[model samples]
Target: MSLDTAALVTKLTEILGPSGIIAETAAMGAYLNEPRKRFHVPALAVVLPKSVAEVQALARFAFENGTPLIPQGGNTGLVGAQVPLKGNEVIVSLARLNGLREINADAGHMTVEAGMILEEAHKIAEAEGAMFPLWIASQGSARIGGVLSSNAGGVNVLAYGNARELCLGVEAVLADGRLYNGLNALKKDNTGYDLKDLLIGAEGTLGIITAATLKLFPLPAGYETAIVNLSSPEKALELFYAMRERAGTRLNAFELVPWIGLDIQTRHGMLDKDPTAGPSPWYALVEVSQPKGAEGGLLQAGLEAAFEANLIDNAVVAESLADRTRMWAFREQMSECQSREGASIKHDVSVPIAAIPRLIAEGSAAAQALVAGIRPVPFGHMGDGNIHFNFSPPVGADDKAFMAGAEPMHDAVYEVVLKLGGSVSAEHGIGQLKTELLKRVKDPVALEMMRAIKQALDPKDILNPGKMLS
Candidate 1:
């Protein structure tokens, strides 16, 4: 069943003009190389469709010829979802499909084509005096299609929610080249089935998302950001509870970072100055939003309560926008700072909010037992319970050897995560990287249902074959 590469290229060239196709292996480097650099398989060709009709034609050809199609966005995904699983598959990049379909800031919703860069969307919302609250480290390059497809949950999940929650509907091209027009700005709809939810977070297995109507919120007057010094994660959790109690819906972000993060950032000169008030074992980046025409100081009031309760001893509350930006820069640089340290084994996981402390404690201990002196840097959205549990190899340890032991490290962490009623893949969806793990840990009936839906939607298995359910 070998694919006729030459014939396939000819057909693709006909469907999309020469300008829209990248058949050369050298030219496909950007599409093949993912952020993690873990997946190296090359795609047959990279096809850039400018319109939804072009996407439909591409899907039709893929479906008719039994050729696998991997839909890609900004190529910023950590998991290998936006890249090729097999060398024979063709990558259908949505970069050219990016366009603003419609927008209504007053209605708190806007419809935009899938290829729209996330940062561009933010700009569009800001121009209308509205806000698209999904903020991620890669938002500068990540597109709406990949963001919604992966159901990205960034720092603001505490307030505005993730990509799926932020999106009202999506317009996608099905496997058979049929366009499923589900785009809408409706706040409430008694839909027969949540097709939007299914397509979203599906990692391109169910369909190729072309456009999405995203939910927007009124712009906040200001943000109160702070970095609180804490002795341990337990104290951070207590402080998070206090902040939430005080700010409620206004509490935008609650991120936890260990001392290692600051140390690495400082060592690498990633920060101009320390963002925390003073040295501590852990620091919590807390942010509360101030509504338009409302009195401020909710965060300061909450911090005062925390200080009175002895939950936190020292804290640095941002006095100006520069201070706030610096504080956020520290939190945003957590993942990048790890790369400077050394080879790191990372897990994007979530547990019951109450079980976060134990997850970190036991998970760190387990890793140390396996690799002596492994630096544990478990930090992330503490308010929502998703911790980017990561570890840097011991000082002077072999980077290759450290990565060789990644499997055992993953097993150890996932064991703890599952036992504590947590999801192994939290914000990052189950791309090719986690498909096998999903099979092992996912409930039997749930897996069956997922397979059934995938079968119904993609009967020929041409849409992102060997991903997610595979």
Candidate 2:
């Protein structure tokens, strides 16, 4: 039997104290309004826990009472993972636990509480003359817990890897308020079943991550940034291979942007000046980092080779920090600029690195065929095969009507993605939004394993109950 709403609020307040609970619906806006603004369900209450012990207590209370708990941090997720799926669930925000526990700049690792903001983590690393290279647009407000939960991939993933790769170990709170003390910086540990891996991308369905040991690296001397103009995705792929062959791990980022992105940014006056070399069908924002005492001009030499190989036509290498900032501003503004045009149907999917060109060409064609004149705005980390395959509705199209037809458009685009052996959900894990899609595309055996693991970890089904396994 479900507890009365007032009773649930009272119980949570008793557990967390008055300052820790937000039971009023009107004041719950900040926690419920996620980045995408797609999920707006009212939660029973938003609970803020100050420490791991508090989180464990709340978890135990929720488990015993059969109250669903939604683990959240910063609320900056693109998917609906950080927000409430069922109105009866209680949200456990980990913002109050932001604190860095340990740092070993020479040993190349740091221990930080999950609620530390991503930007703050970067600052802590820089203070020690080290670096933690996860660069996403939401880093300013995105917390460490959500970043690890979603296994976020950003621009620098080409060199350092995603959150899962960057993380060494984690300290989490299990369903029955059991504390999991797994934090360590050991480079090698052939221990049992890798619980860290299991919890990293589980989307809060298994446990609440409290603290984590993240891998750090020596700070690079500087970065060589360039924006190259390409005729198509195929040529961009060629240029990418060329850069990877030359720079190897030094090639930090190779992002693909469409001509429509440029058009929209220019129309809205989002950039002070054009960042690309000239008008082209496509562009690649390629970057390479120069380590301490390493040779400079590596990116220029690589670009020169690409020009000779007929892979690139024109390029603009950043001569100053301001120039690099403007170029990145153009690439980062791709998502926000889409809203200015009108409604956009989006898919964050990934294919093999080599199959990226085909995925874009075929996916664009499929989306266009579905909604005639649909502006295809497919772009993103081409180096990693993940593309934000989004479509801007045709000119003068009603936003609601266009959105209403989104289901068919998504089906058409996903068909192409799966045919190319790509993933339907790449960096963003399945929250409430893609549970049905996960059911249809995921392998049956894999789904069964996921369900088994979910059951093993959370038997009472009180943790994000309807999400990911919907």
Candidate 1, lDDT over the whole model: 0.93
lDDT of every predicted structure (CA atoms): 0.93, 0.93
Query: How displaced is residue 271 in candidate 2, in Å?
Result: 0.4
lDDT of 2 by residue, 1-470 (tens): 36899898888888899999999999999999988789879988999999898999999988888999999988988879888876888999999999999999999999999999999999999999999999999999999999999899989888989999999999999999999999999889997789998899888999999999999999999999999999989999999999999999999999999999999999999989998998999999999999999999999999999999899999999999999999999999999999999898999999999998888888888888888889999999999989999999999999999999999989998999999999999898888899999999999999999999999989999788888998
Clashes by residue pair, model 1: none
What lDDT is obtained when candidate 2 is compared to the true structure? 0.93
- Tell me the spans in candidate 1 whose CA falls farther than 4 Å from its real position: 1-3
Question: What is the per-residue lDDT of model 1 for residues 1-470, given as tens digits with 9 covering 90 to 100?
Answer: 23499989988899999989999999999888899899999888999999899999999888888999999999988889889887889999999999998999998999999999999999999999999999999999999999998999999999888888999999999999999999988879995898999999999999999999999899999999999999999999899888888889999999999999999999999999888998899999999999999898888889988999999989999998899999999999999999998798999999999999999999999999999999999999998999999999999999999999999999999999999999999999888999999999999999999999999999999888898988
Off by over 4 Å in 2: none
